[model samples]
Target chain A: MGLQQPSFSLTALAAVGLATAMLCAASTPAEAVPSFARQTGLACEACHTVFPELTPFGRRFKLNAFTLTTKQEISDINERKQGTLSLADLPPLALMFEASSTWQGKRVPDSNPSAPAGSQAQNGTVEFPQQLSLFYGGKIADHFGALFQVTYSQPSDHFTIDNSDIRYADQSQSGDFLYGLTLNNNPTVQDVWNSTPAWGLPSMTPPVGLAPAASPLIGKLGAQVAGAGVYGMYKDVFYLEGTVYHAALTGKTTPIDSTSGSHLDNYMPYWRAAYERQWGRHSAELGTYGTHAHFNQGGLNPENGLVMGADTFTDVAVDGQYQYIGENHIATAQASWTHENQTWQGLLNAGGTSNSKDNLNQYKVTGSYYYNRTYGGNVTYTRLSGSTDALLYPVGTSANGSPNSQWETFEVDYLPFLNTKVLLQYTLYQKFNGGSNAYDGVTNRKASDNNLVMLGLWTNF
Target chain B: MKKVFLAAVGLATVLAHAASAATESPPKLAREVCSKCHGPEGISQSPLFPRLAGQQAEYLDQQLHQFRDRSRGDPHAQAYMWGVAGPLTDAQIKSISEYYASRKPVHGAAPSDPALAAKGKEIFFNGLEARNVPACAGCHGEQAEGQGAIPRLAGQHADYLYRQLRDFRSELRENETMHANVQSMTDDDAAALTEYLASQ
Candidate 1:
């Protein structure tokens, strides 16, 4: 696909307002109702490069968690817990509240008494969660089952209702056609991997930060999958899902990044899709997704007082996962390309220079062993190369050069209980790029690397 | 056909139990050995052992079972419990489950900082950059909901919360990130935060 200019795209969108509304739901953060990222005893990494994808395990997880069983571990909640009931009592509503607290290296609170007893990592700092969510899962009719979740976060106490889907799921049905779809927002097969999205991974910066930056652009809590799309099963083995929607509204229409000025929103149209096949314990999946920025004439001005117009950005990726279950070993590999040659492409405004579609290619390979069961470990290496397109300026500089940078991560996950897990991870970063496009005043000269250690506990009811 | 089916059902139930049952060692001598301190079914009726009954199975597995030789080192939990915790291999320790898993979690002490939880809520959802504190949700969970190995901090006993925070700061409770996360908080913050969490 080819990229376009900014000002021109906006005029076209202005001419077609209602048409745009149907394509784009209001531009705020889309909150898919929060569902357990993993259903059953299935873990996140099983489906996604990280979590929440439909790897065989992930897909099976959904079937098992939501459809297969309604026998939840007994608790005090008064809501309906059964998955099967007569049509009169078919649709059910459920709710769960979860919270967390963690400590990291040198960041441990002054009050942590265990600080001394723990390894050096615990001597650091900690993080936690403040969240509330409501879930609604039931058979809307005979063949259709509904899955919807709404989550509320702290601070502004923003409430998001997203991650809603309606599926004509019949595991018994075989052939080239199976079933899944979204009435509002939807996630393609690719978004299953949290690390794949803009704010979800690599970086949260819009058009500008498309390159590299000093701070982490990745957020652990995943972004919601919304918009409109559908997914299905083929012969009970192959799987496919696709979605088209408006990306989360950056808020500031004036095309600037999260930190550019008062922090405006970024709006763009996008589509994503993926395909997968399961051959016994071994399986593979392939997917691609991209976004197009449409300049909204009625949008706000850029932080710098520039009349921010519409912009476009798109990313395509092919990933494969293979698992050796008998011995409990899993391996994965993926390559992604983000083409920024589109109108909204490039890091900061390319300083008004001749433009080339910004091209970024990145991938990772990881393998882990069960090491019996309670003790398991994995090692992975990832390299992300950003575009030198004029649009990617300021924040996108890699430490090694102006083109490529890399991060190596190693993690150990121990599941002591069927419901609980502990993950210890170490990440090494390498940035190798430098250039002044539109944002950063200085370009990096020497390659730099930082090491981070993360230890976390995750559980569910 | 019905008789055969019933027989098969009986067989299946037995088989399922055998498959999932934790590797049994010295069968939990609930009264003879455990009751000396932990009370029956590990409820700790004495208020000292901190009732273990009805606890999330995962939480119990982690505290008494995960750590090896260092298992009994926790200062907050009773020392005798630690001694018991030390010899537990994964399956052996699992033999001793809590009564709480099947029971409801009851409140311990009354709230002191009546508004503390509300204040803590402020910090939990939002970061306290002014106090150099990050938001609690960044790790624990949204709405105080605990995840897979992380304990459900919300709705826990305030006294237990205070003791845990104190133990973490003192290096008595050597869990994962909490050891470090707690290191930054002041005792007051921990207590206030605990009250906040408990109230939630």
Candidate 2:
């Protein structure tokens, strides 16, 4: 009775709020958005807080292999009614586009000598249709499904495979346990929740200057790695997973390229553990994940003669997320901390480092609130600090001998339609490269001068 | 910065007006027109009328469109929903479905026979495989808290469930898979199962 009391109260509150809104006729009309809604016949609210931020039900849908669908299907049946070749009659596809304009607080000093005078620096710049993306997501077979994404960057003028996660899953008799295997091209690409770096807050942002240079290596190692893992849930409460990753060379037919970053000394191993609880309108999750990798740094300098040493790194992270979904409002908060330990054996052997060990730590926290899923805002604070080494980190350029910096971002979003969003984001820098003033010693650039504001439009079909 | 602030305020005002216009449209139509048998919030007092509260919006909307087009030809649907859904515009149907989906479901009383309910629970969890019946939990959720377009069966009306299951078995309902699934189920089984589901 005690366990059920809160749920009843939550339902009552939601009913009151919904009834009031119904009487007031505050909801907008419905329109088709994407492949998921088209195939499942469910509205976006069943799965998303906004766009990619998932609700509890969304997490379940992904964990179940995304095979649940109401679309027309073709299949060959066996004795037990097993599907021989199950496929959707319609191919699930969607197109997405984004446009943005960026404004920096101060003009950046021309750092490139090849740049022309007029092309040097500006306070504002706009990219019409900054990015165009294609997505093929939904059930692929009876027990298999995938979410694949490809993007074309306007600045680069190139198309590349971005993120892909394919899965095969099954459930137990009583439906209390679910198990699955995943094959993904990125480290956290297969993650179902938004608390991780793969799908966290600020889902979209500009690749502007003054962004932090030193991010934890865990999130950076993706895109060039091929990873495989197995995961399972116990009664939908406890989850566990382990994966191994290998360097995968892209744009080449060969398995390894010595000149590319896709060269690995050994396979990296990653592990995850989480516990989730959902009751009433409140849901929470606490989890830990980590990865260990060793890279051969000899190929970094082919002219120096191939050295036999390697740089080893171990990154450990912990994260938490909490969400409250009322009838008219939704609130979410997420936090994560990562600590990376690196041993510069190859760099030390090459006379590039004075120390053998270095450590980098990063922390991020964000909170968001939405009203009627139409208008919302969020704030985020992020900090990065690491051991100082003058030899390892130069005193000039973007970094200043120390990997220490802090920044905060505030963003407001408006959704005129369910598939369209307009957002404004402002960033403030408190510290950069261990100094608040004259962080870039060469140009005497202050940390506060790097502040930026961006306006963005995102839409999907 | 000031320009940005002013633009935000102006956009907000326009959006507010747009939202107000929507309120005057479908929600008013839903409340004023469709609240006769289905209550304002979609909780029906009569057992003959199926409770629409907490049903999936997608499922509800699909059914309304089907009824208007004569695609769903079940006796009850033909007798009741045919007339009700005939004149509903697409916008009105969507709004009514959304309004009903947002309402809270009401749990009914327990079965008069607890032993029969226990047997029904067994059938719900572990289907009578010898009779070729699949577990209801496989499609509906563990607690019958449906997903996607599936309608929630927990706390549904016993009379409605019994009639639907019987109709499915007799080919009176047009669902082929459901007909196959319930063909092996007996009248006693359907009665017990409905009682158990209604009490959930």
Candidate 3:
């Protein structure tokens, strides 16, 4: 039983606010742009098992900074006969568009306070153009390349910088190893593995679907900061990378001020290490990555406007992937788990939370199978759990003030062309916001009420 | 005597430089570019790409020419090799072909099913009289070590071999001789042959 006769107006505002805030941190589907195919003169299959998942060759292509081009080039040489310039005759540019329709299991309560009893909002949503993106995704020089994207979402109605990575790479003279440097705005945007947060499974989701309230800071910060790092692969087996990040606030003043919400206090450090092995038609990879960050909570003292104390977050994760690519069938399984340690000293001092220390954990596993790169299906199971804080996760949204949720997603996809994909995805939630029934405490809403089914068409050219 | 010694040293230096320059590009290209997919020395680990090591030089040359000229209209040829071969000069192709052909060929892995291998061996060495199929070894050699412009089938990836046979039969590969030889071969027969060839 739940409090069904609560203040409808207040509950409606709180629900909308929570949903809107959560949407900003939800996963944005990763993409495999066609510019790389055009630049290298290779078909999409040469680099990907499907559009966004990498093959061994695709991983190597990214490791080389996407500069392996066979296209005609305009060239120049210096006086010493050292090459000074080499530019592709055709610019590496591409466009991607996605449209989708989403249906939720149950309609939400109407926001209008004067509405008749049992009135509900619409249960179905159609987004004509869920997202449209332009990409510059290939070589710029002999050893430098970039995958830069600008995207427009129907919800936002404005174009903004999306996931972008620019890199410079070269191989050792002995051809035994490769090393590169990357500058990117996202923590795992430069990663080559799908097991990483930036490219993980459930490649796409409805823009407005309900999501867990808490996630690791490492997975949440994308396009909000800039990072530079160096990575290397030895004998095509071992991989290692390290990077440091600083705030690159968007739509903000030149110099960050109090207006900017909680931001990186100074810099955050991120690192990754992985090992891969390939034999015959099989490949496997195991990896670990983590980040440590200190944040300025933006709480200022009233007297002098001096900044208050800071909060800290440390997140570490382990991931692995196994791929079997037969002549006609391709199968892949990947799993990742992340543990976060949070110390909200600043927020605690400001009375924003009931506890100064808490922890959260997320686990995900996905398995997929495809036949001849044409039709495929995947299943993903995700679980999230964290220590409860009454003030942090209040009663209306989280019945028990606990951040615990679990869900499973199943998706089937058909690709008529390598660049075009049609997908149907369904998500079932076993628990949300700490409970299955009356999860939100005030609305008599069940976790299953948020079950989502989405049909989408995505293509890039 | 001093003048003669100086002349001899200068001639030796010139010859050495010319020899190095003449042989450099192919190995560099092979190591840096082709090796990404084909693996070093063309012993590719993935069945999606074919092994080029120990292939007949003349065959490699002909294929490269076909790829560059868009005459090899197979799906894979159009998708992968056309753009790669387009920019190569004839000399570069010849040198690259020779470089791979000189490398040691791959050794076949043991077949998973010995019975399948045995059937394939029989077909490779003897004709299917009822089906009017010719013995593959008549042209591929007793050991499947092809000669001149014929391709070596021994130790090739089984999947690659099977697909090529299918393409030839379907005329997708546009090889009159190969199509004539494989047109009547059934999928089972092709599978057996690939198994046997892959096991050498």
Candidate 4:
């Protein structure tokens, strides 16, 4: 059967919207919650410079599968004196709340076409609880643990499974090497470093905002697939990991068929390698990671039985981080660059793209400084560029059939208590969707028109 | 007489069993859990964690007890130690303390600044008379090898020692003697003293 007409002919702008929504939803703020503190009997500083940004010790904590505990446990032993059951007296459960208000530089066009000839949506939006999440994190068994989250987003008004990483970890008898296996729902969700896409900078941003039309495939697949991998660290310096992913759609029938949304035709493979060095109060890491995937646009045509071919994407990235942790001052800097190559065989077969192959590159650099973990600020700059393909990035969103955008983000954070934070963030766009002005080709929209200011309160218990 | 003999035999067996249990579990716990941060032999790699090897058994025992009872109110103690010490038994604490104290002591790395080390050595041996600061060696040994209930300062990370001095001065650590000793000390004095002690 040939490719389905409706699925293949879906406007590039719609596809971009879907991708952007998924990326934004998936990048919700991750945390180092109080439950972990209760389990380990260690303070938040032991594992984090700030919430969500891990220290060397925190990285090790995750490498060990978050199984370290100082809490009392109910236990049992077998005839050979081997432990059979070990359950923490207190469950590792935590709840997080995020409330935010966002102001756009200019209001967007009202989406309701039946309204007046000229209309605009409200310029400011408030989410009483922008997002609420419940987490079950920490040791699940002797050498197994999990950090699982279920989130309720205000815009969606529903609870859905979020990022999750379950692991089985162990160390060598001589304690020279550490190794683990992970079953996670998202790429880089199991990674210890924030340089990776999943935990990268701009950690918190407004949920509803204008975003770039194109991103790497790896950045868009979070929570839509499942992966299993093995990872290891040698001498606490070198790290290596490999994972393979398959489609695992939520709220969808098992053994997916053509009716399922976009899904992998076969397992995607992801790999990572890194080297970290520590001396005194300074720590630095350099790493490279990549993924390759083949996806089938699932749908059936009235004439053509099914969409027949798969589109392939190969993504590779290099990242680095440097940190200086002092008694009263802490500083961190991170940078990353990603390259993606796309082959749209299935889409081209259905006349979806003007070009069969395209390429994209993204670069980001961020720096942050905090004093006593009480007050901090962060600055980040990001640039993304890709090949021009008319049918792939059509008019309405991309005037020049190109996906090029650049922006800078500035944020200031205040913490009155360890578990609570108040933050103000601003984003300024330089170029979006190929042009600074008339970017959408349908209206007099300027790249700067999408600028955003957001203020938020985040806390967990 | 026969009943008395039987009772004595039973008591001796019980004592032996308790001794064996005490000896066996502490090492396992030390290796499996404590070693994650404090290093396998109690010489920690991170300055965030203090080296435990060759510390005074009495000091270690006293501190663990304080942590368990929530009396040691330092930020790190509250964050990291309270939970760990919460579940520890008296015997476990005693065994763990002795286990760490018996290990080989750490040899401090060379001081980053020799001048600072020299100044610190002076402050260690002789009181900072102008500032009314007492000599550190008076209570800690002349070699900085501390006595009972006094922490050994030699070979500890300079960063760790400096923070501890700050904590003591602020009374966050809540030790009357330590607070009195460090209250008059300035930042420069703390830097110098920690440098010298770390180079020991």
Locate the minimum summed-lDDT window of 10 residues in model 3 chain A.
A1-10
Taken over the whole model, the C-alpha lDDT of each candidate is 0.42, 0.70, 0.82, 0.81
lDDT tens per residue, model 4, A265-308:
77788889999998788999999999988878765343443466
Model 3 Cα lDDT, one tens digit per residue, A325-382: 8878999999999999989876677665678898989999999999989999899999
lDDT of 1 by residue, A34-108 (tens): 233222112233233222223443454243223322223222323676334323222355454333332221221
* Candidate No. with top TM-score: 4
What is the TM-score of each predicted model, taking all chains together?
0.46, 0.67, 0.90, 0.91
**Which ranking of candidates, highest TM-score first?**
4, 3, 2, 1
Question: Which CAPRI category fits model 2?
Answer: incorrect
Cα lDDT for residue A57, candidate 4: 84
B84-188 in candidate 1: lDDT tens per residue?
444445675566544335445544455666788677777778856765677888767885555545666665655566777677777877765667666777877
lDDT digits (tens) for residues B56-120 of candidate 3: 99999999999999999888898889878888889989988998899889879899988999999
List ranges where model 3 is wrong by over 4 Å: A1-13, A25-27, A109-121, A299-306, B1-26
Which digits, one per residue and each the tens of the lDDT, describe model 2 over residues B74-183?
Answer: 77676556655776689978888898888888886777789998888888888888888888888888988777677788888777788889889988777788889999
Location of the lowest summed lDDT over 10 successive residues in candidate 4 chain A: A1-10
RMSD of each: 22.6, 19.7, 8.8, 9.7
Candidate 1: share of reference interface contacts reproduced: 0.00
Candidate 2 per-residue lDDT over residues A1-461, each given as its tens digit: 00000111112222231122112211111112277766665556656777768877678778867766655578788899877877888888988888889887777645344555423365686877777778888889876988887877666688777777899876543344567778887777677767787777777765454554456667765456788777777656788777778877556446453444324466877778899987546789999998888765534455653454777789899999998876568899999999989887776776555578988899999999999789998998989998876555444422355768899989999988768889999988898766788764445667887788889888888
Clashes by residue pair, model 4: A42-B79, A42-B80, A43-B79
Give the C-alpha lDDT of model 4: 0.81
DockQ of each: 0.01, 0.02, 0.20, 0.19
